[model samples]
Target: MAVQPVWHFNRSALAAIALSTLQSGLAQAITLMAPRQMGKSEFLQYDLLPHAEEHGWRVRYFGCATVSPRALTRRLQEALSDFAAGEKWLMRQFARLAGQHAATARAAFPERLVQELAQLRNEKKPSLLVIDDVDRVLQLAGGDTLLREILRAFAGTNGQARLVLSSTLTGHHQGLPALLQQQTTVLTLPDIGDAFVHHLVGQYHQLTRTKREDDNPFGKLSPYQGITWGQVDEGIMQDAFNRLQRIPYYFRALVEDLVLNPERAPAEALQVQLARLQRHRVAVLSWEEMSRLDRLLLTEVAKGTRQFYGDTLRQYLAAQTGAARVSTSQVQSSLKKLMRNRVLGQEADGRYLIIDPHLAAALSVTDKA
Candidate 1:
């Protein structure tokens, strides 16, 4: 089957809102919070970056979740050099018009690379930095110190530069919100909406369209052969989107399956995707990392345990771990680990919720067993 082009749902308005919030001086940095595979990365690259540039702001993007401190620092320095060199033309014009000499211009630059990069922006042109998976970076050894340095760099008086950080629930569990409450604005990326579903339906229909002379009326027969693509429309697409929990990645996967295998119903494709997700490498690795107590906590959270440190849960943990006793601190520590790993999130009501849908589905199977 031929590969279909990527379908993008325009989110310029959301990008505008975020940029406006930054321009209004409400916050120096904005952290967009969402679950994994919900299209945060795509939005940053396709939507936010372009909008910032169109508005005359220089934009730099970095995904530093898995990199070492030295590597991350190197990448940032490279970005700084590239952007600074690109803007040197403008700086030169300013120097000529102001009649400033080379020595004074060089001396005016900030000591740090990041701060120097920020100095490139002025009232007419600002800079925006989009950093993804900031939660993981903050959890790295000495990560907190590095992050504080970056924050301080942006805080300088040199022309304004805005920071946009992205994180999952793990960041919240690790106290990201409270830690940066005074300086950061938190935004939730909304789910894929009706427009996206509508687009998928249209694309599927276009792909499945058959020629009149074809022996097979639908041009090709799908393996499942239970439903024809003719039956798919916006309503069916909306149903599939909801069933997939409005996760863009899974929904797109289901549509791709239908495009490749036209006989499969949307419902069947959804089931296939969910099954595949249950065995996903990340999910499997996370499950392996859990201790016995951590596994119990996961199942208990799936069962809606609000009082994780209570006597009943402590007794259960003690019995399960075969220990003489389980202290409240011990249970608390386990829960914190789960949160840090992005397995669970706590609500304002003190209820624990599974942050990963794949893990939650796996837990549901365990519940039935």
Candidate 2:
């Protein structure tokens, strides 16, 4: 099937890379690690979900950011409901089969879903399971101990059942995917190459229907244009693509928004959008309203200590700030607050540091960068 090749940058290629994995019966798991706006989740919803259905598999999708690991059991039941949609043919057949054995229908699919040996023999089609935003849930729920429990029940059934799981982080955490990594096929997401980004700009331009502009984003996307045609030199294209790679999504958005406004320079628009994102990331932190105890914790973190663990690190905050030493539970609560604020990074070793060096310099939110 032809891909729509959305201008989200690297998504169609990523989809191509992912869909190709289905050719192998061996489970090929992947994590797309490109920039935030590269449309990793969109690729799954658009490309993988429907395409996997062609193999006669019923795809089950749940997101960790949308639902916690502790909620996996209930959420899986809900996905079964979506699978058993009123208009669905498979569900119709399930219901028809149920009429003959009314007692077992409700529990049967789920029971068989957990154990593939029985399902493989009696099932009419294949099945796929998807869990998205696993990293967020792992961060929130303390790893995917609960989520892995559900997945472990379905292990070693790749031929009859396959799974597609997504998380934002690249490395293993105390997360669901990490626990299951030994059995999974891991794929890392690649960023957009300098060679074809003009193609990305062109794709978005077609979506916009704008022909020309002042300091145009689309027309002068040098890297894409350079390798693309005789219109621009390769050196100039490479130079431009290199300098602006950090903000391709910003460029796309600028082009799209400015297409109608013609008066805007795409570069200036890009600056505006990136600044807006940083501000938004920062503003989301304000809702926390850090208590005096919380501020004390932050004050300790600015001092920098390796032995200072997550909540333990925060303990130094209150004690050193001349405030009450935060209670064990309060310190734990403060740790979560800092993590959610994106102002601190917690290593697998249990140490919490500022997000990254560059972001530390940005002095806004602590990004994993």
Candidate 3:
């Protein structure tokens, strides 16, 4: 969000919606889902953290991005040392990190881990495990098992521990929403401060010396064909916000296309930029409607550049189709389809690409459930 004079919106309201959703006990965890950069972290750091602190919840904040199953275990071990009582399961984690040769450290630690975690209950303080980008790392480890581990490990009314996992997967990540819906309470981030858009417009215009009222520069370019958005109209603005509000990364990407790249301003280039956004919205919306197997294939391909095959796809998907065996021919067709839709793309190297950062994030959830 850009800084502006004369406040017009209270962005904190978005955070309030998330804060109120927190619950104690074996009660379902609260999953903060929204678009990237919409302040998912801000909601955690500023709103939830403060309340958790007031409630005396010890926070072991972990960012799931770039974390794998192995990496995740390490981070959890470290976090245990940070917030849990003395003599935690951490030494065992350290030995695990040291490798299997360290036999003593190989001792079962879950019992000790549970004991130390239970200790948080007696502290005159409430402790909450705050994990950010919960979705991103989950995809890396490849499933919702991490979610089950976290909940099983820490979620309970013992008031000793609570889980608050947040990510920008609400409008995207078709897989996570349903997965989370099981033991996780769902709450659409309520409409933000009404002034958010107006304030943003004012700030942008003031900074750039442009305004919707004073001038509609794109109005000149509106004559072009295939432009999904044009003219800075209320409808256009709302659409941008719809994408931006659900996923903050879209906004950043939008600003880059609209304001940052003035060198290629207007006409074909401009249309292409907006077309980029529209494609992502389509993929996200469409992916949300896909079956679990189909969605998981997307999740796998999205991990990085790699050719997916029948065995690989089957390993991830519950059912297999004659045409979708994921062999060379099948992957080629799937890649072609994902690319045609503009969600999965390809590079000069011939590997499929994911042009949208938001989609990548969706593919990467650790499991808000």
For model 2, the superposed segments whose C-alpha errors exceed 4 Å read 1-13, 19-25, 28-35, 50-73, 80-112, 115-126, 136-146, 156-158, 170-177, 180-183, 204-248, 280-337, 340-342, 353-369
lDDT of 1 by residue, 1-369 (tens): 112236766688888998888878877888887777888877887888888888888787787765676576545444544454445747655764677765654453335445565555644678788888787666667666656766767777353778898887442343345645555778888876778898877777666664222526565753434555466778777887876667788888888887777667677888998766655514323666679988888888777667777788789889999999999888888888877765676767677777775467557668879
RMSD of each: 7.1, 8.3, 12.0
Best by lDDT: 1
* Model 1 Cα shift for residue 42 (angstroms): 0.7
Backbone clash numbers for all candidates listed: 0, 5, 21
Per-residue error at 242 for model 2, in Å?
5.5
Q: Would you give me the overall lDDT of model 3? A: 0.53
* lDDT by residue for model 3 (276-347), tens: 554555444376555454455566656663756656555444344433334456455555666666566555
**Candidate 3 steric clashes:** 21
**Error of model 2, residue 238, in angstroms:** 7.6
Error of 1 at 238 (Å): 1.9
